[model samples]
Target: MTQHRPDTLSHAPLGRESAYPEHYDAGLLYPIPRAVNRAPLGIEEGALPFVGEDEWHAFEVSWLNAHGKPIVAVARFRLPAQSPHLIESKSWKLYLNGFNQTRFESRQAVVDTLLRDLAHAAGAPVAVELLDVDDAALAVTRLPGECLDDLDIEVTDYTPRAEHLAVGEEIVEETLHSHLLKSNCPVTGQPDWGSVLIRYRGPKLDREGLLRYLIGYRQHQDFHEHCVEHIFTDLMARARPERLLVLARYVRRGGLDISPWRATPGERPPEPLRLSRQ
Candidate 1:
């Protein structure tokens, strides 16, 4: 097993689209190879490291017209999990900013162009909904304070009888805990930090292996949502748990903290546990 190291990622302004590989198709959604897999470490099941979520920044972006006037277009984007190209969030942000200086004859043109560009970039079917910014209602805000760091954690050396345990089978369910800590932009190497939680019920999972897997992402570079999904899928595939829930509550960045949860449609995730930046 490799020893953990302090993160040393640096941050810089966004760059051109050509800087990244064109794996995602503009018309489809897909998954890419993850940092956890690339990292040098042996990951088993239970002892996965935890990284807090709430460390991302989305500018609550607005578009401007050629006359430098603000133009409001509400959009909802959905990218397929199987798309070839995974549009980097920073690049997406920059791409959205580009529209600020450009002109579109109508709101529909703006929406269509954005959907097309995003879909093409992701290489998957990307969905977008356009509404008047003033009329569009934002999703409910769950966390409303400076990120809290006070968490009562209980760490147990979990041992699974099976080589792998089933997912969502009370793998470790008690108080909130973080597994791994990692944050980085693929294009600029800007680091984003967060804690992760894995709750499951089935068979007992291997604690040490899970920890190793979490620590393995120390040097990984990926977005928060992608990271959470990657963790969820990896566990599902490796453990084959009967039930599983992967929820990441990232610290706030740019006035927004994204929390992505994936589980059986009917399953309900616990309330968000907001963590402070370490």
Candidate 2:
């Protein structure tokens, strides 16, 4: 029952080779306290300015049926932003791999176990949904609003610079997106490609400046959740939007994809729309 803090990154099985477990083992799940990153963002643990969740999609879920035959399915887990901790991505992959040889009576049995273990690790009630590999629910959809990738602009900076974000005097509401969002993994230093969507109300954000601000993350190293929070914080400070929503849909790595969204309170969150890249 030991909880992991940010300093425990070295203990995580992310950049190291690991022996895949052949049976169920919830111990593989590692919880990294959210406060570790929030503190740096000036976000208090209990007094968060935004309400949202991290939606995780796993495509390599598998386990043995009662007859010892293998059953495979995809899974979606919705972890609230208020959760005390966020499950480390690599540890989550390892935990799921542990079910490869485990047997369950029915799909419900598998779901119940997942609910119990994941909720315990998250320190919050996590929504778990298992769907057949070909379920229509897994259909891909496009990101809302306009794509900023086509904007002709120059970008020499690779590090995040919030000052690049500028808002005009005109007030408006719009959704903007960019597929060039890229950041490196803090542990592995591997690139994490994603599409970022920004929806906001208030002063109009300069599209070119917004793209530059996002492009600034190209060489940044951080987790998906932290990156989104950083963007949200920057927008609120520089653009001064009345209401804002920041969503990052990261491409899948190790058979898992994580999409984290943060929004001003009372703003309705969007559906977990699967992008073509996912």
Candidate 3:
């Protein structure tokens, strides 16, 4: 596959400041082509190897109900990984802000608008659900896996080093996670912190080396989805796992949080769980 670099997203509203929209305007949404990053990773368009979704949570979602009374609620959006584009974070914030003052006859009206706009921007059918702000399902929970944060290892370089990944002779199936996963936004250079969960069945991965490999991403610059995909790809190349699943739950920023996961065919996806730091 021919490799291509990601386009400079200087025109996007990611690192720039702009006035928020006062009314419902779908034009506020900006779509970044997923191919820009996938190409460099050797992933071809329309032939993704994983089945997953980018799950987004918006906490500041609100709008005016019938009679212009304020209605507040949280929103969850799920976009398939095969989507041609992913909505830029800042632009998504601005797009959602447009509903702040807009009046809708019912909750369904707001949901319909969100579904239509997000699905169009993502270039795939999106699932949008509005939940009460205090919904019990939104409670914070711990990642279900053997935590790797306590591993004592010396790290000199922060740049991603895929060579650090290795596997042992023993075959095993296990789940491992770490809260140290972090990367910068390619356009904004802002830090994005998240917890990563890895589940696989194959040659036992070197736990120390795995932690070192993840820590190396501390200074990497990429989008949340791309970072997760990079980790998945690197592990596949090094460990050659029979079954693999990589999921990252990033902390919320600008009133929204993004969690992306990639898994091999027939692998079960993890449950939607909010991390403590999210």
Candidate 4:
């Protein structure tokens, strides 16, 4: 059950060559049911142990203004954790490309449309913001808390093993990060490089074991959101932490990057950051 349920992730667009559209087509967006992956993790949708949103950054958005002038800007989308669906990445890129030749009255109009379409697809009220290219704060932010990679350890297995999570006797609150989180895309089998940040308040997790668990994902294959949820679920099941937050930054693929944040209900994540490799 390490991978997504077959029937849950079925889509014609994925694992296929991209055929970009030249006009606006909300139909280009593909939605995958989240329940498929949650089921394997024993996560009941309503009784989820975490609360957070999936943050998406679109860096190659361009369209026409009212005067047929070209308009370009970066987009930030926040899809709540409660959302029943997660938009497929390839489909998302295709949907955004459809706007390349389309016309909009203003940037707000584009944002409004995105909010509507994405929310409709995700089955939740997704927040969307359009930022100017020169906006000082971009996705280039760094991970918060502490760097777990600072530990010197040995690595042998790349296979994901939840059993490696060992905890100390003391209760603690800390944020740990690692840049070795690597997983392949389920569709294309292409490598997805990511830096993960784990924050929790509970028994102190053994730094060495945590680092090994991250490295275990090296050969894992799945979508970014699913991978993060799997990590959260694995930690919760094994360590039984009182509170947890799993945030991951995957390098851009197709000019888009997805950062998924999942935390205990009503928890806010640390400030945004960009790892050196990102």
Query: Which of the numbered candidates is closest to the native, going by highest TM-score?
Result: 2
Task: List, residue by residue over 58-163, the lDDT tens digit for candidate 4.
Answer: 9899999999999999888999888999998888898999899999998889988899889888989999988898887674567777898879999999988998
Error of 2 at 172 (Å): 0.3
- lDDT head-to-head 1 vs 4, winner: 4
lDDT (Cα, tens digit) per residue for candidate 1, span 161-224: 2223233345543322353556566656666666666666555555545654555555667666
Q: How accurate is candidate 2 locally (lDDT)?
A: 0.91
> What local lDDT score does residue 131 receive in model 3, on the 0 to 100 scale?
95
Clashing pairs in 3: none
Top-lDDT candidate index: 2
CA RMSD of each candidate after superposition: 10.3, 1.6, 4.0, 3.8
Better of 1 and 2 by lDDT: 2
The whole-model lDDT of each prediction reads: 0.49, 0.91, 0.89, 0.85
Clashes of 4: 5
| Candidate 2 wrong stretches, greater than 4 Å | 1-7
Encode model 3's per-residue lDDT on 1-278: one tens digit a residue.
11112244767777887898888788777788989899888999889978888999999999999998999999999999999998888888988898999999999999999999888878899999999988987988888879999988998989888899988899999999999998998877889999999999999999999999999899999999999899998998889999999999999999999999999988866665987788
Candidate 1 TM-score over all chains jointly:
0.53
Query: Model 1 lDDT vs. the true structure?
Result: 0.49
Stretches off by above 4 angstroms in model 3 are 1-8
Clashes of 2: 0
